[model samples]
Target: MSVKPESASELFSGPFALGTFSAASGPAFPGLIDREGQVLDLRTALSDPALTMRGLLERWSAVLPQLRELASSSEPVRRPLEELRVLAPVEPRQIFQSGANYRQHVIDLHVAHRAPDDDRPEEERRAEAAEIMDRRAAEDLPYVFIGLPSSVTGPYDDVTLPAWAAKPDWELELVAVIGRPAHQVSVEEALEYVAGYTIANDLTDRATVFRRDMPQIGTDWLRSKNAPGFTPLGPWIVPAESIGDTGDLQLTLKLNGEVMQDESTKDMIFDVARMVAYASQTARLLPGDLVLTGSPAGNGMHWGRLLRDGDVMDASITGLGAQRTRCLAEES
Candidate 1:
């Protein structure tokens, strides 16, 4: 733990999906680890035979043939049965994120911030000091957030809105994962430390957010951000190397397959270079660390329609894959 780990390879050193991927000896794509467990050993299922760390490090994205070959004859580092008990792969740390990284989100939140008296009453106003922190800090890209690691539900997992959230909204965000240690990096060369991309929904409590009369309140995004199973990530992460370029990608949000929001990464107020450079200027970005760019438009708030218990939402980004979630509202 004292010395820098020279042996670690960004691709192989996972916050992996846990189960064996279909192409074990090749790249591991993210997927829902069904409660019943199926197609879990993707790595072992690959045609390639050498399903070890050496194979993965050297082969990164080579797509060698026979990569999907079953590894029934091979030995696993851990006992097979023991592996099944392991929970789904998730980041060990809070997934870091930025607020208003996108142009539309900034304009949207800005309007909300300038509204009249808060819908919440006097006592409730004092209580939600956490939510108000966002209004003041809603300036631009490089806004950081410490996400709920436990809140990470798989791509197809159920997203539940607490009974108290009157306006549960979905915000589609593209998340960047840090592959290497980047401290005080320059925007000119920040891409070197990136590992890959994934999808994140910055779901918020809109009812409390757009209150027209009051000043913004609260440090806790707890009410507005951290709803149960609110954060959905995975489907799979495209290796940063595979991504080629971070800008100019298409981002979209849909409800039951109907497009509600369509925007391009080019609209991002701060590009990846500026974002990574700014974040690293003061804080250290470690492996598995996430830099969540803020969401684009087409959220429920813009319509005044809130997420209901049975509503389904999809957050998709080009190359990053889409995460589909079913909303669950706590009922009395």
Candidate 2:
């Protein structure tokens, strides 16, 4: 149930972007998508039929110049973009997801999920949440968790809403694609390690977020978020250099053509640099690893309208790209 957008070029920005595409049910290959809606097969262009998008990122420095020159010239082997099936731009080995990184989003969660017995006024609750967020931003470290790479699916692929998932939700995020090796890198140098940017919808089963059976164990991110096709990632990756300010990117998610989440990256309590640096402190950030900056203010929990069968989600990040995913109920 893949729904192709009206124009693929409108979803991406810049003169060119990188992606993975397949033709006539053939094996996927690295593709260079130009603004003219043409795809130049990187496998043929680079004389490596087995090249993957992650493989290109591993040698991004050496490959980028060649890509630029190839994009500029008239290539004889290019194909029409509409004739191919787009896949996830890169297959990441590690996915680091930041949690509660958005200021208003955390505040909304705090206010919405308060104890039923608590009778505090809404304004007071919101104010208390804001103060807590401020204190955390000023003093505490970012909250990050590991996500499975196996959960990733193509941007336009259908997402199965598991029958047990009583409350499925969408949390569209801006993902930073790593190019350079980073271990215990400083916040100042974190951005330099980013190769490019892409969009990811961090789908969650809100019902399984907390483990009632093991309260002391706290949140169960694996059960809540690691289902297959839980993360629909990338129409393509836009070079970080092409996007000057990571702080001001706009993230928008529309459910059935109605905008549910529309917020700016400026609201992030822990920015991309901080999240990346924090993750690098514990693990080696390699090329093709993804650092997902937390989602913004509007989510299904905030609006009290969760996902259903046949619901379509149209998610996009500024200059990065858009992903259109359809929801289907899992058969019993």
Candidate 3:
């Protein structure tokens, strides 16, 4: 299928295609994807034998200009997107996830799980939660947690439902891929360090999110979120320049073809720049580091429906790309 390239003015910033491609000639290796949904062997394009996607990110300041020219230059030897295997854009060195960033999503969660002993009107509870969120955004810092890089998997890969996770859930997030080394950056300049944006389904085990014995320590992200294939990421990394308003994009997810999560990034209590800036205050973000800007509600936990074997998730973020993942049970 021939995909017409977006117009020159409509092109994604640097709009470089970065992913692993597999063809009949050999196994999968990292390459550049073009506007027409085709792959460009990076070695042939950059004329550098050591330029992998991660390498490109590490040198993004130098490579972006070249990519901009390459994207518009005469068509090079290309391979159809469907004919090759698409892997994760890059194996990120660090993964940071923002929690409770979506105002409405968090409010809905609190309202839904109100204490049974306290009899309060839903309307009053919702209003109170909204006030708290607004206060948090104004005065409190965002809640961020670390995730294991090993949990990463391809966008098209199957997600293994861990045997211990009885209530596997999905959280479709907008991932900001860092292109520059950032330490103590301001919100105004945070986007400058971002290479691109991609899709991430932050799969969680709802049953393990909290600990009765260790409530003081708070959520146990390691066990609740970081299992092999727990983070299914990428079909493409759309350059940040190509994206217009970071907070206005639509994020959607379907379970078995039914819309389970459909919301706009505008609902976030803290926007992308804030999330990046906040994460940077604690850690030096290097190229290829991923900061997931939380999901916009409609999670499985809210719907009273959790993932099961044979379930398929179709996740997409406006302009970034879409991903389809099938669920399978983990063998003991």
Better model by TM-score, 1 or 2?
2
Specify the poorest-scoring 10-residue window by lDDT in model 2. Answer: 5-14
lDDT for position 2 in model 3: 16
Tell me the lDDT of candidate 2: 0.91
Using Cα atoms with residue i matched to residue i, what is each candidate's TM-score against the true structure?
A: 0.67, 0.98, 0.92
Predicted candidate 3 versus true structure: per-residue lDDT over 1-332, tens digit per residue: 11211221122334555676667677556676776666777767888765667888999888888878777776578676767767787889999999999988899878866766968998999999999898998896899999999999988888899999988999999999999999999999999999989889999997888775877886789999999999998877787888857878898999998999999999998999999999999899999999999998899878999999888898888887688889998889
- Per-residue lDDT tens digits of candidate 1, residues 1-332? 01111112112212232222323244443222321223234343453444432233234334322222222223222232222222113353546667666655555554544436556554554434334444543654356657767666656667778877877888887777666678999877888776567777777786654334544643456556776677776555556655677788787888766787789888776777777778888888776667787777667766667788777776678765456678777776
lDDT of 1 at 48: 45
For 1-332, candidate 2 gives per-residue lDDT tens digits of 68786575755666789999998869999899888889999998999888999999999888889988998988747888889998999999999999999999999988877877989999999999999989988896799999999999999999999998989999999999999899999999999999999999999998899888987999999999999999999999998888878888899999999999999999999889999999999999999999999999899999999999999999998897788999999999
Model 3 vs truth, CA RMSD: 3.9
- Which structure among the candidates has the greatest lDDT? 2
lDDT score for candidate 1 against the true structure = 0.58
Worst 10 residues of 3 by lDDT: 1-10
How does each model score on lDDT?
0.58, 0.91, 0.84
